[model samples]
Target: MKYKHKYSLTPIAIAALVAFPTAALADGPYVGVSGGVVLPEDSSNAGEFDADVPATPDFGAIPAGTEVGWETQFDTGFAISGQAGYAFENGFRLEAEVAYSEYDVDTHTGLTVGGANIDGADVAILTRGAADPANPTVGAVIADGQGKVTNFGLFGNVFYDINTGSAFKPYVGGGIGYQWVDVDYMPSGVAVGADEDGTFAYQLMAGASFEVSDNFEIFGQYTWRDSTEEAEIPLTLVPATLGVESSQSIISAGVRVGFGG
Candidate 1:
């Protein structure tokens, strides 16, 4: 009798075979680009006085031996980034990225000279006068010296993909990187001028991706990044130091294209 040897495939084994193709299609090498609206936080200790600066009469009430300083704010800025990475079938990814960002000065405030607050004036006037006390034109233009702060960076990042067994994947990740962005915007006009560029940095992010095709996805993300060190740039017009520290909040969206799994 040709009756036969009974044949059986377990449920788990059958399911695995059926799911193999989808798993393979879901992970691979990918590249992405994104843009963001950036909001920058204020940095303190923006300027300080030292002995080399003459106690000039041009600076109103800001004599020598006065510690020069101010706080700052930025208008809404923009950021762009590009990255390449490999995604594993087990739900992990590694990427390398390059990014750039820029912001326009909104205003300067909290002018403290010799530890005294110079209130009731446009902070720009105070900063300009303090920087170039000899220039009588200083402080007249409330809108003068509208400078910008810019950034360039390289980063290595790692991410964990939360697989929902469907078209959507949510993720959380962080990275450590280096930035070349230490110039002081207020002084840049008189001085790209106030700076000590390059510092260690770090960031944290949360995002979600929607698959547009088997090998393509669109994502939205929110990130917070900060420089781990303070940068001090020597003032060109005066005997003073401009101290800058950076922190930012970003909301962005991008697309990723994938290759072989």
Candidate 2:
């Protein structure tokens, strides 16, 4: 009698077997590169002279009461970034990234010496005249200018992947970091430069990815990023400090390569 011998796998053993493949698929290191378009919100600032300068009696230059208000609109620009990260079997990931972006100036507005709001072109004329010794009547000039804002950021991010047992994965993430921001303006033919260092920065992101092979994937993402109020930049004669605030949204697409799982 070849008596039948019965054997059964335990629940734990079954679970282990089912999870083995998922663990292998989820554990790995990856590197990615992305490029995108940046759409900026408006940036604005107001400034006044730190101190009034007394005129020399001989020169007869009266103290100029100078104040300025500035508003700048930005055009769409380009953004690029690189990241490296590791994924876990529980669908969590961590990454470090570096990014760069540039935005063009669309418009600049200013306050005039005559206590009226003026266009940038008129401000430029006032600024030019204020710099000339012959045009003593112009107390202050605001200039319309063209320039670019460039920023570099470094961030540490965390994400969660919604794996649906298919080639496609969707994810959501957020990050906090530091940024170096530089603003260069050619206002009234005079160069004005300002920079902020180690400003607090943050971002929110969401995206989906398609696996192309065992070691490669492609993705598209949308992100919103912002920095804390920037440090002040000094301006001419009146010793005014200019302040700027900025933020933007971005759409990006990229490729990623995985290392061993």
Candidate 3:
């Protein structure tokens, strides 16, 4: 009886020492801010013109030896976001975040099939020469020329927590969302369209949280997202009426805040 009593007391003592501190460490309701570079993993724009379109302009053979080279490049920019969430004692929770990002692309094309290197902007100017109120064809023809492209979008996110333990918490989550896009073509100076079509966008996120002081903690996270957008081009200089589609993958890191348990 004495030995069994001592053994029961040993188990009770161990539980008292190990369980109390862990219960006391758990907290909730946090908010945080994070800013970083938005890197594009796979970004591309591709489109072709429709020669069958009535607005299609005529291009005659030009002199030989004209050199043309086409190039497209997008500039990197900064992104900042804010997050709020509730941290639980268990290894699970929920979070909401809002983020804003910008990407600017400049496109240049020089096509020299023969000796004639075609200038897309110059074609717009020439097509305008045949301008008349009765003949709106010139405007339509000029608008068909491919020019500059600018793209921007807004995003919202909600994620499920998978990590909540010890001093360092690790988690894995997935989110479904949408992006609003604005696409504009050159020469026309008008927005071809905004892709509010609500196409599906998804992300994979992984990060760790370091407990700063129960209610407060510093966290670092990385996310991978896949999305797509499109721009329209007039058929003036291009071989056909063209629509350019850009496929984008973005990776970003930032901190977040917590609240409510």
- Please report the candidate that would top TM-score against the real structure: 1
Candidate 1 local lDDT, 1-261, one digit each (tens): 687799899999998665643433257789999999999887674566554433334344344556776666778899999999989878889999898888877766565667766554443444443444344332333224366778788989999888777667889999899988856554325542456578888889899988766677899999898888866667665566666767888899999989965
Candidate 3 Cα errors over 4 Å, as ranges: 1-29, 47-71, 106-166, 184-198, 228-253
Total clashing pairs in model 2: 1
125-148: candidate 2 lDDT, tens digit per residue: 433333343442222322345677
TM-score of 2: 0.75
Candidate 3, position 157, lDDT: 49
Give the TM-score comparing model 1 with the true structure, all chains together.
Answer: 0.76
* lDDT of every model, 2 decimals: 0.72, 0.72, 0.46
Tell me the spans in candidate 2 whose CA falls farther than 4 Å from its real position: 1-26, 53-67, 110-144, 236-238
The C-alpha TM-scores of every prediction are 0.76, 0.75, 0.55
Q: Rank the candidates by lDDT, best first.
A: 1, 2, 3
Could you tell me how far off, in angstroms, the CA of residue 41 lies in candidate 1 after the best superposition? Answer: 1.4
How many clashes show up per model? 1, 1, 19
Candidate 3, 1-261: lDDT as tens digits: 455544345887987656544432245666777766555432233444333223324334322222222334445545566766665656555556665555554433443233334443333323423324454333343234333333233344444444434556666766555644344444344333233223445566777666654455566677665554334444334343234444444445555544445
The TM-score obtained by model 3 is: 0.55
Tell me the lDDT of candidate 3: 0.46
